[model samples]
Target: MSATTDGSRVRNLWDEAKAATLDEPGKLLYRSNLLGSDKRITNYGGGNTSAKVTHRDPLTGEDVTVLWVKGSGGDVGTIKLDGFATLYMDKLNRLRDIYRGPAHEDEMVGYLPHCTFNLNPRAASIDTPLHAYLPYPHVDHMHPDAVIAIAATRNGREITRRVYGEEIGWLEWRRPGFELGLELARFAAENPEAKGVVLGSHGLFTWGRTAEECYATTLAIINRAIEWFEGELKDKPAFGGEVVAALPRERRREIAARLMPEIRARIGRDEAKIGHFDDSDAVLQFVGSAALRPLAALGTSCPDHFLRTKIRPLVLDFDPANGDVEALVAGLDGAVEAYRQDYAAYYQRSKHPDSPAMRDPNAVIYLVPGVGMISFAKDKGTARVSAEFYVNAINVMRGASGVDDYLGLPEQEAFDIEYWLLEEAKLQRLPKPKPLAGRVALVTGGAGGIGQAIAARLMAEGACVVLADIDANALDATKADFAKGFGADQVRGTRMNVTSEAEVAASFAEAVVEYGGLDILVSNAGIASAAPVEDTTLEVWDRNISILATGYFLVSREAFRLFRRQKLGGSMIFISSKNGLAASAGASAYCTAKAAEIHLARCLALEGAEAGIRVNTVNPDAVLRGSKIWSGEWREQRAASSKIGTEELEAHYRNRSLLKRSVFPEDIAEAVYFFASDLSAKSTGNIVNVDAGNAISFTR
Candidate 1:
């Protein structure tokens, strides 16, 4: 329990953890979430944790501090940067203190700090104060089963005293919010030496000087408690088992984002963190149960969790005997109704004329005997935190009670926690859509080929696009087509070299001024050359990279600057060739340049993903119709190279694909739209191919 034990080794480990987190935060976050996944340290949207970073205020021109907490309902085990809410620490502190000293929590509406770039993120966490109160630069709050095992017992206070000897204090479980904060502050004052604290029948709190210390302490605390309980408590009959499978990060992110759409829509918050869990038999049993027997508790870790999580999770009612998922779903549906009725009844009982009653449990943990717990948030962070709390609570109880003594608060106590005014105040903030509208698009090489197709698509999808091409006549003609299809306001024409930075900058400035915002950039301009590596000329190499690789950097930089000034999260697309994926005979520079563009797209994607902007690449193989590559002269040249009729070359390429059809700009365009649309809300740093059958799989 002493942090100083093996101080040097711990410091070395923490230093390494800090290096990794600082060097590769995105990687660290995903890996951490993956590690916490499966074990149920957090559920769908139950908990959130954050590290404080210093920043300066743009308006005040003053130094200020900011903290990024998980977005509302995001799965902590699966959150990315977007899942975190960036709030001014000063503003957050004020919000927590405004109602202090006899002010009724609901008497005054609490104004939460806005997100960066003026976003009014809704629903500050139930545990926001708890997160802020930690002396550590980083804070980790989870509903760990081991911690919760301590929290959920009638003898929690006594056990905590015996275990930590006043090093940690216990808060009577209260619904999380201003009241929870006020109570936690009091506890902190009383226990000056405390490194951790337990909320009776709620969860645990821990913090450290750095992120690693926080993570390690959390693991140590939970594990220590687990060891204690295994020694002291009776082992229950084994039920569900752990999956122990490692889901790819992409898959996990996809799952979290998919589950959190509604919550994100409402809160304008992203969890910004993804955690993996370690699965144990207890977690599986908790999640696997069809019907949560009366033995299971009905509350979250604390009142504050209501903000991070929902009122309660949808207690999945399942029957292990049937094992029919549909039947299990039906049982869950029945359980949901009963839960709703109970929630309604609880609200009525808890409602005071002055306090509003919460409609449901902010989160509901399923106690499936064999299935692991699943938490659902409006977003993933919430779900993950809730799941973690359940996991920890289960662990804590397993250790605390030699008998299965998990306790749910009585209706009266549950009512007090539910109707706590301090918690309700946190929910008072308004949420808004991500402000990225009114953006203009200026695409390089956006005429007479795949570029033109991309330009047309961007125009149709709300961007006023100026299509640029080296071919002046082609630009004009394409503008006319865009006018016919979308409208005059949606399309513009320009003639410029993709390789010219000055031209790209000037064009970008003009577009921004004319359209009021230049937020989207499609660096889809490039020329192709076919030659072997040795035969590839300096001229070909330079020109190829100049138009494709360098062009993307030039054009994207202009767009990014425009977006920063406009305070918009822009979107970007790159048109990379299928050659980017594979080398072809007689096309060295082209393939190399194309591959470079793909890599550039990834770099840009990572940079732009958190900017409320998207970056992606489209690799199309032989999209020969209406493209310059398929223009009369080029087609004839290709035909000559193959020693076949131009018509025969088209057929050969068409038949070569798995789909047995010629790929067109339209084929690539559809996939581009998918990447651009709300449908691709989470697809960044990804390459989607629209190459008919594409010679083979798009991903290796």
Candidate 2:
């Protein structure tokens, strides 16, 4: 098996489940987990698995056979037993007879819920009937990269026969439904000796009497396909050396940063869209191939991919090694227009009158030679998913090109799955997303308590976040936490000292190059300082001014520069303190610097209004929970000045406010979110106080 499949891990998981006296459904759960864990086999929520088991009929009190199959909206890798939809095999198989001619997609789908036998209310996968028609007790269906490499080729059927011989049966392209299920049943009847079946321009299906047997067979078959594909590619150049060599990493990112914003505008202007640049070796190699332009335009390797990635990716002509922004944007504008025009025509010709209208005609995957690939979507997770599918597709195509010509399902079949009611239901099921969906935000000092809280909130609202922090350790920890909660790719970390002009400029440049462009800039990097004017030294004053005042200026300055260049209105938020508006004894330096930061925001707000840029400040007080400044002797001295215990300071401040509530980091974050979001579109040059109704700190 390929390195992707870990037989030992699967065995151990199954063994542990058996030791716990797990049922057939539990075994199927482990089997699905093993297969789905391998991206080479299946992407997120892309495959289905099932096990035939005997259960006592609810009313009859008699043992009856049912198929426990992976349910819709569940990714097999992490799915639990509850994620499987149980259906009586007899009732599911009966659908094959009831629908004989044309695919009654809607009728077949509607019948599935009625046939469901389990108490679990979740809908079964659309491929449930296919599992029922199979004779084996366990079934595994996955869109493996290697099988797709051959299955999506011109000579796919011939290649399947050549590799697997009679061990595997080959079926022509068909949109999965009752008709396809019936066809598979017929093939099984004819080829009872076959261990698996390969569907053209679709994926592979394997079955056995046990979960282990089914999973093993899947890996064995995929391995043979991969081996054959590799053998065929022997001595191939892989990727043209000259093309990849032409674009250095920095140059590629520079071009990508400038290009993504224009692409987003061309695709849709109403909402912010996110872009992910995939310049990994595999992607770059594939994109730089001599066969790229011709083969890539053919379509996705499998019909399932057509939903996330379109039938074909939009290929741009601009070279990453040497391309001007204007020229690149011009080329992208033409390409985007052409792709949409062609998609509109395709939909008109192939779509049913009652089918869902066309989705955004925007291309999901953008293929740029030398620069690699970029996947665009309304959010980071989907963008990363699209990129993953395309990266795998490129490899499959590369391998297929060696054996035969790459071929995807015809345009009509793609349309069938693209607009399928089953697929549409998944999208409809998702709750209305937050308005920040697809927007990119950069939170400076993002690894701190307040910064981390703000970054988390922004990401929760569907914005892709870049955590820019001077502390490397905190930056990495926060990045990891965000990755686990959201996704590994949605949140990125950058080590930046905002006071350094070079670092600020480079960080903004890198942000553009890496994430396309920034939509929100939270200039919140600052250090707290406290001293009476008479006691304040040059060192204390400089330290406070450098980070609290100068730091905000440098970061905000870079943000404005990028915002103007992209021609996109943006938001800049400064995390000032209530001390900026109202003075406290022994806090001269800190108070004066924060006051400077607020004034700077006003200056930027005035200059930025013409560029659609909005600048604002969130003045928070006594947010000491996550404040590093409130630690050690500084915290003790500040508490001593108030003649209270250090821990009592929070409550003290809360009581001091009219609302009698302690101001938390998250309270400040909410204020920043308001400025960053469209809620404050008409409001700028403002200060929103988050001090729990402190009269002295109230914004004037």
Candidate 3:
């Protein structure tokens, strides 16, 4: 919901999508994200949506049947498949021709299993063809609150006419189905270069072939409208006590968490994961108070909002200890019904035979008695988006037309988007797995070559990593080097003993306190001890287990606890040696501890999976020459025993596997990075052999 912005002119969603078409998956993902974001603005699911797809013809010996749509019961905010209907592009293109709204659509095939619709509501989102007809590979559309607010004013139509020229077309609100989409297509095609559009008394529309362009254009128009209004309206003095600026990102969420439950309680449901979301202070402050000037209906900016934001946020008068769920629900429902009826009357006024009529309000917005205007999304992300859209909507309406002269889509026209098939498709989809963006991570023993390599890799692909180790000097030195190479404050360091509970506890506390949350843990700390079983002392055995095995348990246990509490899930990795599984004569406790560590990793994997955590191990053999435990003399001896020069010995060790090269700590680090990242999202309870291909003891 929060996007960092700089001063730049905007392009349209249509253009952005077109440029990004080559990244077919990215195009689909970005467009869907855009649409999902749009839905958030005014609770558009069941309102508006977008999609970017690759279409080919199987009949003509080509690929076809690419679709992403919002589903029947889908919300723009949390839309997934079942939210969208997939059909051959040819079929959708054909449907676009006969879409004469209620008249022609009433006779068309009703909802099919592939339609992604519930039995009661069989309407394809009206904007389906609107997206399908896009010349660009990607498409985006939104029922902006600003446009709608301006459109809904007393002099809405006149104000819109004055603010925007035909560079953006204005349409009379009409019934949605095939008809509205056709009209939109015709308008778009006519003004190929037009960057903006306004639907009289309805909403606003912007497009681009690529995500960046589309997002930019949408923001540009909305922002411009807002600026215009602010300049024209002239402030009415700061009322003595000046209004304060908004809070920072973290503080905003903190405040929202405290207020969310109270808002949810008013809506009447107690079981849900709505907490995993974001919110807007501007929206909260604006809508929370009924005392604010009530201008017009910004509830369902367009029907698409319903899918994402659930019609609109309830307007409740909340207090400190209020548990009156019934009153709250009633108030919310009553407000929503009022909105629905208002829409119904508007529909009646704007209806024609080609129009498709909807039965109720897709979404509703409540002017709460005191708290603020809450933009509701089906989920947290959507809600946050809806609030943003609302903010833009206010800006557009006020900017384009004076506060009292807003314009919007007519009821019938709004209906078409509310029931758009293509728009729904945008909602009912999944992102093509970016894996770990915006996620913070930590790598234990990260100062060494292996840890450094893994940390660097993760950072390269966009992940924040905290390099931790017990060696204070090494930790600081590593941090300095890493920070230099990456950026200021890029790699952080903490020195703590893996074997010490107090130290481990202290480290974890510091991590959680500093990073807010941790998503990855690479347990790569261990000590090597060479002793025949006959001469292995209990003290040595205990030390090995303590550092190699028990330490693993301690580190893993706390990470597991943190994962559970944070509920975001995480990944844990253990670095075991090939000796753990194969017989190595001189090492008894080392092998045993490592072997036990592997099993420990497996068991941990099983338990953590429930909480979305993953556990895996890497067996690295002969890759320890430069490790703290291995000295230059040790390396020389190992190389000599191989009957080759040191470099050749290293190459032999590396080449021992399928590839003939020495496996350095970096090689092991790569494996660790994979498991710690999304590449191994589904890979848990498994062991990766990082020793090239040394067949020490063929388990299978």
Candidate 4:
């Protein structure tokens, strides 16, 4: 144990962990989970772990030494026994002997796959050789923020000597490959008593006789580095900028909202990109700082971060003094284009001959001064992850800067890691993305069961969503809930009373600001009413018409206006009721309003044809399992009107449909997704009934 070690704590955890897992790989998995669970040690999948073990070789009938290295693309936090690629140590050592002069990136990558002991298809990490070359039985390598703070500093070597003396070996900047492996092994041999190796401008490496020892050594090294940094860099500088305090928070949100949609559009997939603003104090400090551009230009804290954040963040210049939307959009367009050009140049200058196709040119992160930072990705999940990684990088850079000047690998070196075949393999493994990759959508009554379902579906298919509803509490709660799954950047909530033109107009304007522009609008804010035509009062009928009929008109009218402005052919889907097409007894007001909403959609379709806007309707009946529309009087009235108990009435509706299944919110959401995507590109002004195959509800 070193200076930072807490032996009792490590011993206790190890005792508990080892008691649960008697197998070696299982024990290694437990250790990996412990390391990965701490974000400070590794962000997302930025690190790897390994152990040396013996396994029976079926062909030779003898125990062989195997290198159990973490598999490529697996997060150590949740990695399982299978997540480790079992490699033959002797074969890996043989390949190392033949690695001569300059190590070829592709050759090393190719050899890794075939060197596995069990012919395991899982790709070993690119750093497998580095781990294999180590003499210890257990090894842990990580890019902890504290370690990067020192490694990325100007005086990294001197700092390393001052901290660990001859106990740690330091290697100059060498890209992760066979060469790095050789250099680290040579350094270890030269200094027999060295506790670990600190890769210059790279990361930390530690080894021990056992997994527990190695794990403890890593924590000790990290704690010492962090302690040294805190002691030496006592006075941290405050973040300052030309306009950090000059701009208002509201303006920052407005600018981010306005600029994001266009930025997403310029990146050029059909659906809009999801944008997240990291406006926390730390984020604001870094993004708003005067040194942001220069510090950000140094590149990511480590090369591994390049996978999630790219070489650098996209920084945009914006001022609230001038509010020309097009000009702002054009500026974002130019910046995005410049970023792509830079990426191409970076690729051409340093890419290996065998490197895979260049990754998406768009920067995953965008640094907005007044608005903090906005991260973008093809989907909500990635966008959030990118934001998290960037935030961590920002803090690391800040800490590094507090001491000696912060530094990272040169551009060419970073490009080598960014385009490494092993890294590219991770993206290739993802399932084909949804077609609506760059679209933004708005769902009214989003707090309702059907609206929530629609928002979930839209996000699942790669669209950012704005949830608008009159119930402020419900809207906020739903937004928070959805954000956990879809990302906070992709999901937002706005209080909107659809019947009021002012509220509708404001909500649409907010959508335009928040998402840059709108692509899909779901006019689903309506209430259910049931009464005989003679018994219907003006209050009941007007209330129903105002919500079901006029609400659709107001919302659609605003959406159409914004769609024309953006000139991106959009979709407007109305969630009318099955009662609209097939009148239900004693439900005169609800039926009439629903019928009017359907006709309104048709009229809008005709009007929007030239503008490339497609309007369609989804007629769903009795989506009552979670629907707010079926509560209290409406449910009782409908059951009484049908001359049956509530349960029997529900059963009658279920059996009435040809499919004999209840029409649920999810079923309607699936139909909505169809119209929103390219599947209904040529089809508009049509009503798709989602009432469990109810023939009577169908409309041509």
Predicted candidate 4 versus true structure: per-residue lDDT over 464-504, tens digit per residue: 88999999999989999998987676787889999999988
Which regions in candidate 2 have their CA more than 4 angstroms from the true location? 1-21, 239-246, 320-326, 643-648
Query: In what order do the candidates fall by lDDT, top score first?
Result: 2, 4, 1, 3
- Candidate 3 vs. true structure, TM-score: 0.48
Q: Tell me, by lDDT, which candidate is best.
A: 2
- lDDT by residue (tens digit), candidate 2, 546-612: 9999899889888887787667789999999889999888988889999999999999999999989
Residue 569, model 2: lDDT of: 84
Question: What TM-score would each prediction reach against the true structure?
Answer: 0.45, 0.93, 0.48, 0.86
Model 2: weakest 10-residue lDDT segment is: 1-10
RMSD of each: 18.0, 2.8, 12.2, 4.4
Best by TM-score: 2
> Who is ahead in lDDT, 2 or 4?
2
TM-score winner between 1 and 4, please give it: 4
Q: What is the C-alpha lDDT of each candidate?
A: 0.60, 0.82, 0.58, 0.80
Q: Per-residue lDDT for 23-104 in model 3, tens only?
A: 5544444445544554323344434455555555445767664545454445554554445555556666666455456655
Q: How well does candidate 3 score on lDDT at residue 220?
A: 69
What is candidate 1's lDDT per residue for 1-700, written digit by digit as tens? 1122232122112346545645333433643464245343544455567777666678877877777666555667667677666777777666654565434544322444443423635345545666665545666677665667677777788888876776677778665556666676677667667877887866777766666666777666666666566565544432222223323433323322222222212122231111222235556554543223433544443444433434455545444444444565335435655766776766776678877745433234433333344443322233455555555455443454443455555566655655666545435543532222233567777886787777766655555677888888888888898888876656677777767888876665445323334545777776666655787789978888887788778887877665554344656778887789877666777778888988888887777766787888888887777777666555665567677897798788877788888887877777777776667778888888777776543667
